[model samples]
Target chain A: MTTLRRVTLDVLKPHEPSMLAFTERVAEVESVDGVTASLIELDQEVQNVKITAEGAGLDYDAIEAAVDGLGGTIHSIDQVAYGEHVVEERRTLQDG
Target chain B: MTTLRRVTLDVLKPHEPSMLAFTERVAEVESVDGVTASLIELDQEVQNVKITAEGAGLDYDAIEAAVDGLGGTIHSIDQVAYGEHVVEERRTLQDG
Candidate 1:
């Protein structure tokens, strides 16, 4: 059986506007914050986006709606060790 | 058996300084960001802190050290639903 592991979704879109739109929607989840969306390359028709949302703020239904709204497909979701980030760090200033 | 579910830790200290000190250390994790520590209550000697960190950046061992370093007790660590907040909410400006 496919392990029900949480993954980080990397979305790609044909335009930056759509990608940004999608990212904005995904950031609305309660636990989600400090989301950063950047453009990668222009050589391809789709723009690349790297999203970092809180495991607490992740919502699948909202993500599906946002992706479809942007007319984009979820290219991939990379599962990182999210638990390591479950604690607080007030010493440094790292944009959440 | 107690499931190994991720939990949200709310730390209390005798002084806001120690609580802040504790929080600062927790934010260093790679996935931790947008950490906010607010004080609550008076009359008593200790301070109350509400910390929100990214699950992706949490480090348990470090948290243990920081908490111990503060010469404070964790008191209570309330388990909050961290995964539901995993999605991005670009639509809102809720600090990460």
Candidate 2:
């Protein structure tokens, strides 16, 4: 079976939880080994954050649930790596 | 001492040495454990490729020399991860 090793997500979240608490909540997901969340932009209503999680076999559903539980909504799945290792996305010539 | 665990580079190379050969040569660098090269664009003159290498402690100078030896030029150091492990770059709101 194919296993997801790492995933980067663009998420929109409220300010109540704080970035630290949001990252902690996501890191507590059963399959996550470690997670890093960075604030990209913030306004009065929401904060746009980038979250990257690494694990042996990540369960996206559970990760999504965790984010939803924290009043966060996934805007997009920016990148994903599967199989034996996590592969980082490289900037290509076509990328703007 | 700080250790560079992974690096992604934007490189331009002639067609004489195929992408496979170029990747193999970079992978053979002393500090490079593994490498993945993907062609981003190609013209009659040169091929623009993205090369990502991972290791315990990567030597950028050596990696540069290897590319230079292969008739390739490093265009840009796209991303780098330094420390205990390789960290994938996440998409931020500021990114185009």
Candidate 3:
């Protein structure tokens, strides 16, 4: 699977571990599945978690829904990989 | 116009404003042009930005590329609204 590097997310309510767990649960954006990625401590109050998943793993709308489902809000979502929209589509096919 | 809530991003390098600025610079993920988004303070060293835009903003692939273009890595991209893949596409349509 293609790797998508640092996709930064902010749990607007607070910097809590539960918020992190929510993202992990709903990582499958649209059709992409998820694999293990790593996280780094960027700051005391925030973390930088990375993962290699099937491109479909990130459903922008779905992700947002998942976050709201968990009672937390996101600030922004940035993908570190450039020119890789297919990565998301790839996962969709896989999920199918 | 519909507003998409928090899309959290983490700049793995550092908790610096420059990193934040980078996200804003390439805020146009792909096809989705950008409108104004807001950010909020969540913790000791984190921010929670929010915005309202046509679903046609936030290209997963493009946003990833934009981040890498800046040198900052992403942790993960979370969409606060679940079941909203159309948001990315809406932005794409707008861009087209």
Best-to-worst ranking by lDDT: 2, 1, 3
Q: Residue A62 of candidate 3: its Cα lDDT?
A: 61
Count backbone overlaps in model 2: 0
**CA shift of B17, model 1, Å:** 46
Model 2 chain B: lowest-lDDT 10 consecutive positions: B78-87
- Residue lDDT tens for model 3, B1-96: 443422444334324554335544454454433322233233455544332222334455565576567565664443433243543423344442
Candidate 2 vs. true structure, TM-score = 0.52
Q: Where in model 3 is the C-alpha error above 4 Å? A: A1-6, A13-21, A35-57, A80-96, B1-96
Number of residue pairs clashing in candidate 3, backbone atoms closer than 3 angstroms, sequence gap of 3 or more or interchain:
51
Sort by DockQ, top down from the best:
1, 3, 2
The residue pairs that clash in candidate 2, if any, are none
Off by over 4 Å in 2: B1-94
Q: A1-96 in candidate 1: lDDT tens per residue?
A: 011112245666767566556677666644455456655555457777665454543445566566667766665443222223333323222222
| Candidate 3 chain B: worst-modelled 10 consecutive residues by lDDT | B32-41
How many residue pairs collide in each prediction? 47, 0, 51
- Poorly placed runs, candidate 1 (over 4 Å): A1-7, A16-19, A29-31, A55-57, A80-96, B1-96
For candidate 1, the TM-score is: 0.36
- TM-score comparison, 1 vs 3, better candidate: 1
lDDT of 2 by residue, A1-96 (tens): 899988888899898786655766777778876665655777889988777778899999999999999999999988788998766567788776
By lDDT, the better pick of 1 and 2 is 2
Residue A44 displacement in candidate 1 (angstroms): 5.4
